[model samples]
Target: MKKKIILIAVFVIAVAASVYLYAMYKPHRDITAETADFTVSVKQLQEEYAKNDTMFNKKYMDKTIEVKGVVSTIDDAENGIVIDEKLSVTFNDSTKKEIAVGKSIKIKGRLLTYDDILEEFKMDQASVIK
Candidate 1:
């Protein structure tokens, strides 16, 4: 009985460790390949978040979304862009050179956070759609 119990316990431990390792090593979601959950302009998303942040946060948080606006600023060091002075998006492709200031473009990314003090929305793993 003692040997049987010891064997079962060892089996359980091995299974648990395997499960944990698999989960930890699993690849992250590719946001660029995934479809956007919502599509809105920079103005609309910023206004909605400003009005009721908690409600919108529950709705938009951690979800992939697409936003359209003109590029207001480009940070080459960060490989990112601010749209309409309200949304900040960091692109996955550091070599992307299609964007320019004052040019209208569409981008898809996962909504990361809303900075109420700055009144801006931040996204990551972004890709240019237009």
Candidate 2:
């Protein structure tokens, strides 16, 4: 009886550990290394921004997305990076370190959806390519 109980406990613990590790290391779905889809000009992005809708949100909301654009400006004061023309993206310190003004690069991360009075739809949480 004692051996059976101990075996059961070990099995349960092993299953729990496996579940935790899977959750921790699981690769996010919907991530793509797509560059052709994101090759629009800065002016085009600005036009979309003016329309209060972005292709970013249209295509990759609630999923991992990858895009390539020029780094127009870096607002350290605001902890954000402005890409294309008018896309204001905020990211953490590690992401910021990989971006620089005038550099053409790729960003891959989860796309968050937001609806506000100023902007109808927006995407956030983008990571930078090193």
Candidate 3:
């Protein structure tokens, strides 16, 4: 019947679209080895994000960002490191570094979010840029 055929076609299209979206949003298979989408300095990045939180969030969210700045603190307390007291980057749990406070370093990771109350931008699943 034509009606039955039309229903089957719609179902097929719906399944195909679901498959496409799942593939697109799935986490990278090799996140540690993933390349960064943007490279920027701590001060400049923070200023831009602060000025326009929603726009910056949309642009950078879920994308790898490489941020270069002096280490403000290494937070073993949490999951990552804080740079210049503004940008926080979280690497894989197994990753380690001997970075010291005030040492300049670059980190590459997926951007998580920017916190207005803390006035800090956060990143996750990150690695130190050598």
Candidate 4:
């Protein structure tokens, strides 16, 4: 009788532990899926940069985000690539692999708040979606 009770208790504990772990590792729902990708023209992007640098700064500052645009240039040395659109951004090397000039792509990356030498927002570790 004692052995039976101990076995039951052990089984219960094991089940409880498994449930807790599964709950902790569950995938989170993606919020970006609901919002449509922002699309802007290259000329529009340049205008916005000139008109409201601060607002542009606030929109992209240090956030993990996705943007869709046309590839303009790729700089392997700096690991950077540029997207020509309403919000022109330079993505680092990792992003370059995912994009090429004249190709339209969706880039997900962390937007660096600091201004680059080119006066463009630096996008690091960008993942490009064809």
Using TM-score as the measure, the top candidate is 1
Among residues 3 or more apart in sequence or in different chains, the pairs in candidate 4 whose N, CA or C atoms overlap within 3 Å are: 45-86, 79-92, 79-93
Q: Model 4 compared with the native: what TM-score? A: 0.48
lDDT of 1: 0.90
Q: Please, what is the whole-model Cα lDDT of each candidate in the order they appear?
A: 0.90, 0.61, 0.80, 0.62
- Model 4 stretches with alpha carbons more than 4 Å out: 1-51, 85-98, 114-117
Show where candidate 2 strays beyond 4 Å. Answer: 1-58, 113-121
TM-score of each: 0.86, 0.47, 0.72, 0.48
| Ordered list by TM-score, greatest first | 1, 3, 4, 2
Each candidate's clash count: 0, 0, 0, 3
Give the Å error, residue 7, model 4: 48
Give lDDT tens digits, candidate 1, residues 14-117.
Answer: 99999999999999999989999999998788678879988999989899998999999999999999999989889898835788899999999999998878
- CA lDDT, candidate 2, residue 33: 47
**Model 2 lDDT at residue 30:** 39
Q: Write the per-residue lDDT of candidate 2 for residues 1-130, one digit (tens) a residue.
A: 9999999999999999999999999985533343323444445544664575666457545655455678878888877776764456666444666677998877665546544554422445556665
Candidate 2 deviates by what RMSD? 6.5
Q: Per-residue lDDT for 11-88 in model 3, tens only?
A: 999999999999999976555687778888877777777798778778888887788899888778676778899887
